[model samples]
Target: MPLFFLSYSHVPVHRAGRSPDFDRLVFRFFEDLCGHLAAAGGPEGNAAGFVERPGTPAEETLRALADCRVFVPLYAKRYFTDPKCGRHWTAATTGPADTRPAVVPVLWTPYPPAALPRAAQYDLPAMPGDGDEAEEEYAATGLHQMLQLGEELGDGRAGRITAWLARRVLYAAATVPAPPGDRHVPGPLTALDNAFTAPLPAPPTLRITVLAPTEEQLPIGRDESRYGPAAEDWRPYGPALGPLADQVRALARNLGFTPDLVAFDKPRAELRGTAVPDAPWVLVVDPWALENPRVADQVREFDAVRRPWTAVLSVLPEDDPQTKERSERLTRLLHTCFPRFLREGRAGEQNAVRGLPDADVFALWFSELAESARMRYLRYIHSQLSAGGDGTGDRTEGRP
Candidate 1:
C-alpha cells in the first residue's frame, strides 16, 4: 500500500495564459518528492507514492484511501466542486475515528480557508504560491531541518517538501496505533453538495484554428545540393510549422484563448464539419506546396469556408536570381487564392521581412500574427454581441 494518498482535480481552470513556468515547477516538485521517498532507507520508503487513476470504482478508491498513511489533497475551487474528489475526501474523513487517515491539505489554488468544510479546516501545510508566502517559507524551512535527520533528504524546495511529508508518514506510522483490520464503510457525504450541483462558470476565450501543410504536401528532400547544402539534407529544410504552432498556442494561452490546429491534408468535408464559422484562422502555407494540384485544390476548398483568417506564406532566406524568380512566381499563385496574404518583404519594403533560423525574428512574426487574429476575433465577438442586443450573448451555437 502507498504511504501518501494525493488527490487533485483533473479539470483545468480558466486563467489568462502566462508562462507555464509555475506548472513546470510543480511537476518537478512532485517528481523530486517521489525520488526522495524512493531513496529514503526503509522498507515502506519504496512503497511511498500516490494513485491518480480517474474513473476507478468507488470501492477501489476507498480501499486505497483506507490503506494510506496520510491523505494529501491538492485543494482548489474545482476540487471542492468535483463529486469524485468529494467522495475521496469523504472516504478519508468519515471512517472509524481511530482509522481516519491523517489529512494534509496543500493549497494548490487560492480559496477561502474559512469557507472550507469543517473537516478540512485544520491547520495544514500548503503548497507554494497559492496564497501565503510565509507559510510556504515555513514549510521549506521545516523540510531543510529534516536534512539533519537523514542524508537521503537532499537540498532544494522539492527536497524539503518531500522530506517533510516522508517524516510525517514515518511519524504517523510509529505513533498512531492502527485501527482494527475490520472497516466500517462511510455513508454519503453532503457537505460539498452545493458546490457539486452549482452551475459551472463559463470560460472566457477566443478560438483560433491553425491550418498547416502536412508532410506529404512538403516532403523532406534527400538532396541538399539543390537548396545549397546545409547541416542536413531535407527538402524544405528546417523546423516546419511545429515550432510555429507551439509559439501560437503559447501566445493564445497567454491571451486567454484556446487554439485548435488542423492539418491541411484532412479532407475538405471533414474540415468544414469541424470548422467554427465565427472563429478566426491562421494558415501557414509553403510556396512550393501551392505548386501541387492536390494542395492547390485543398487551399481553394479551405477558402470557400468564408471565415476571417490570416495566411503566412513561408520563404527561404537565401536569394539567388533563380530562387527570387521562383519565389515571385509562387507569390503570384498564392495571391490568386489569398489576395491579402502576408509575405516577407525586402529591407526597402514597408513591412518587415521575417526569416527562419532567427529566434527573435520568428517570435516577432508569431506575435504579429497572433495579435492580428486576436483583434479580428474580438471584433467578431463585438459584432455578434451587438446583434444580439446584449453584451452577454450565446456564441456557442455555430462553434465547433
Candidate 2:
C-alpha cells in the first residue's frame, strides 16, 4: 500500500491561459517531493510508490485510496470546485468512521481553513504560497536560513522548495499514524532536516549526444518492415533511438539537468562546441545504424577519448525467429564497438535488449537509465565540491 495519495486539480479555475510557468512549478514540486520521500524511506522511496495523475479511472483511484495510509489533498480554491477532486476527497474519507484514511491537507494555494471541506478541517502543515509574505515567513525559519546558504551557492527557488517539501513530507509521513485496521504500521520515522540543511548539490551540466540514424536515413518507405510506409509512423514502429532520446530528455529535466541532444550526422565541431567538456557524455548507439561507415567512425572517435562515457545499445524486439536473428546481429555489432554496453530490457536477463514493440517495458528501462545517470552525475558533482574546487573538474575531449 502507498504511504500517501497526492490529490490535486491539474487545471486551475481562475487562470485563463494555461501558463507554462505554473506547469513547470507543479512538475518540479512533485519531482522533488517524490525524490525526497524516496530518500527518506517513504512509500515514494521506491518505483512502486507513484503519485496519482489526472485521467486515472475512478475505480482505480478509489482502489488506490482504499489501500493508501494517508490522503494528501493539495488545496487550492479550484480544487474544492472540481467534482472529480471532490469525489477523490470523499472516497478517501467516506468509508466507515474508523476506517477512513488519514488526511494531510497541504495548502498549496493560500486559502482559509474555513474554505476547505468540513472533513478536511483537521490541523495540518501548510506550505507557503508564492507570495512575498510567504517568502518572508519562510526566510525567518531555520529551514530557510539553511536554504539561504544553498541559494548563495547558486541553488534557486525550485531547489529550495524540493528540499522544503521533502522535509515536510518526511515529517508528515513519520508522525502520522497509519490508517485504521492497517496490519503493518511503518516503524518510527526520524527527522532528517540536516540532509536538507546542507548545501543543495548542483546538477552536473552534461550533454547527451544521441548517435542514431535520422528519419531520412532509416528505411521508412518500405511497407514490409516495421519502420512503416510513412516517415511519421516511424516514431512508434521504427528504431527506438528517437523515442528513447525523448524519454531521456524528459527524465533529465526532472533530475534538474538541461541536456542538449546532438544527432549523429551533426558536424563533429558543432558537437564539440555544444558539449560540456568536463561533464560525462551518454552515447546512445543504434547498432543497425552504426553499419554506416561515417557513423562507425563517429563512435570510434568518441570511444578514443579517455573520459567517462556510457554506451546504451538500442536493439529491436526479439519476438520471432527472424526478429531474434536481426536483434542478435545488432547486439553483436554493438559488442564489437563498445565491448561493454547496457542492454535495455527486463532486469537480470542476460543479453536482454529493449524492443520497440513493448513500449511500457522499454519506458521503464529508459527511466532507470536516466535515474542511474542522474546519480552518477550527482556523485561527480559531490566529488568536485568535496575537493574544495569549483564545480568544473577535469576537461574531457568533446569531439566525436
Candidate 3:
C-alpha cells in the first residue's frame, strides 16, 4: 500500500492529457512530495504515493484511501461535489477522530470553511506555512498560484512549502498513525451516496478595519519588532502568530462572517457605515494606537460620527507589562472620547475589549458584537422604510 493517497477531484484541467500545464505542475508536485517522503525514509517507488487515474472505479479509490497511512486531500470547489471524492472523504473520516489517518488539507482553490461538508469542516487540520508572507499567500490564495510562480516543482517558496507539508505528514504518520476502517464493510458502506449536497448560503461580510500604527507612524521608543510595513502587521497579542487583525479575521470567518481586512488609515467613502449596505464595519483597536496624535484624532472622529452598524474591539495584551500603565492611562482617556461603549459592558469593566487575552474569549465576544452590529444596520433600514424613505437609511448628499 502507498504511504499516502493523493485524493483530488478529476477535472479536465488537471487531467494528464487534457491540460499540459496543469498536468505538468500537478505531476511535478506529486513526484516532489514523493521524493521528499522517500528521502525521509518513507515508502519508495510504486509504493510511495497513490493517485487514482482518470476513469478509475470508485472502489479502487476507496481501497487506496482505506490503506494509506495519511490522506492528503486537495480541497477545491469541485472536490466537495465530486461523488467519488465525497465518498473517499466520508469513508476516511467516518470513525472516531483518532481512528483515521491525519488529514493534511490543501486549499487548491479558495473556499470558505462554511462551504466544506460537515465532516471536513470539523476534521481538517490547519497547514501553517514556513513564514508569515508565505502563510498569508497560502491562506489568501492557494498552492495552485505558487505552482505558477516557478517553472519546476520543488523550487523556491513553493518547494519549501511542499517540503514543509511532507515533513508534517511524515511526522503525523509515525507519531499518530491510526488503523483505517475496513473497506469491505457490508451494506451502506459500499453504496453510500455523496456526503455533500448543495452549497451553503453565502456568509455576510464583516469589514474588519485595523486601527493601528504603521512602522513609520510608531511612536519613538516603541518596540519595532511588533510593528511592520503596514497597520495590518500589528500583532497586539505578541510575536507568536500573525497580525491580530488576521487572527480576528479567521475568527470572524469561523463564526460565519466573511471578514475583509481594510486599512483604517486609508480614506474611503465606505468609512460611513451606511455606505456599505451588506457589510458591517468592525474596528479592531490597538491600545498603543492612542499614543499617536493623528491616530488619536481618527479614533475620536470615528467615535463622534460613527453609525450604529460600526463596532469597536480593543485588544489589550496582559503579558506586556510595559504597556500596562500606558494602556490604563489610555483607557481612562478613551472613556471621555467615547462614553457609550466604555460604560455598557460589565459593571466594573470599562470596555468589552478588556480582559480578552486570547482568541477563544475574543471569538465569544466578537460573535455577539458582530451580530449586534448587523441588527443595528437592519433596524436602521427598517425605520427608514417605515418613515417612507429609501431602505438604504441614508439620504443626505455627499455625507461620507
Give me the candidate number with maximum lDDT. 3
Q: Listing every candidate in turn, what is its Cα RMSD in Å to the true structure after a full C-alpha superposition?
A: 19.1, 20.3, 17.5
User: Which pairs clash (backbone N, Cα, C closer than 3 Å) in model 3?
Assistant: none
Model 2: colliding residue pairs: 38-45
State the lDDT of candidate 1 residue by residue for 38-157, as single tens digits. 566523333665655435565655556667656767666677777777677766655445666655555555554323554443323433322233334433343323333334554344
* Residue 161 in candidate 1, Cα distance off native in Å: 2.6
Q: What is the per-residue lDDT of model 3 for residues 159-217, given as tens digits with 9 covering 90 to 100?
A: 76677777766765664444545534222445765667545556767888887788888
Query: Against the hidden reference, what TM-scores do the models get?
Result: 0.36, 0.37, 0.51
Error of 3 at 140 (Å): 2.5
Better of 1 and 3 by lDDT: 3
Q: After superposition, how far is residue 186 of candidate 2 from its true place, in Å?
A: 35
* Candidate 1, superposed: residue stretches over 4 Å from native: 12-31, 42-46, 54-59, 126-155, 184-400
Model 2: lDDT of residue 105: 56
The global C-alpha lDDT for each of the candidates, from Candidate 1 onward, is: 0.48, 0.48, 0.65
Ranking by TM-score: 3, 2, 1
